[model samples]
Target: MAYTPELSNDQSRTLRRIAWALNMPMTKAMNAVFEYAGNIIDKKRVCAACKDNSKCNTCAFNQKRWSGSPHDHQKNKELCLLSLIKK
Candidate 1:
């Protein structure tokens, strides 16, 4: 998805609110939220490797390529959150 810069302020505020409400560090909260969201999205999107019977290396959304490698779908979710924040 494309990033949207228009909502950066709003996203920042929302993140702050979430951090405060959960009584967690902002970065940790953000990471957890993004990871959870990413897993949900991954469940819906077809796994790239599964489609081709090839290794994850060739898949565009390969989980291993992310920060949380092997379980990196959260990284993708973080990217999505960043994009939304940019909006």
Candidate 2:
């Protein structure tokens, strides 16, 4: 049997409108939203220093990615320095 998600009336309407605006099928639109949220959740799981491959070597925190963010991790520190600079 196929699985059906139980979204509220408002949530269903909003998703339908977003799919129409993007000119994509509802399934694709939902996948895009899910993927975006998953990435953000993964990013928030670590600080910028811990997330960087190069910096991870000399990072003062010396924390592993799987260990999660440090206790003193500030909101601003969550933003990656490389991402802020336009390439």
Using TM-score as the measure, the top candidate is: 1
What tens-digit string does per-residue lDDT give for candidate 1 at 1-87?
Answer: 267445388887988887776667778767666554644457326563256545566444455555354354544433333333433
* Model 2 TM-score, 2 decimals: 0.42
Off by over 4 Å in 1: 1-7, 42-46, 49-87
Q: How far in Å is the alpha carbon of 81 misplaced in model 1? A: 15
Worst 10 residues of 1 by lDDT: 78-87
> Model 2 RMSD to the real structure?
12.9
Give the per-residue lDDT digits (tens) of candidate 2, residues 1-87: 278878899998988876776567777767555533433454434555254566564433344532554333334332322232258
State the C-alpha lDDT per candidate.
0.55, 0.52
Error of 2 at 60 (Å): 28
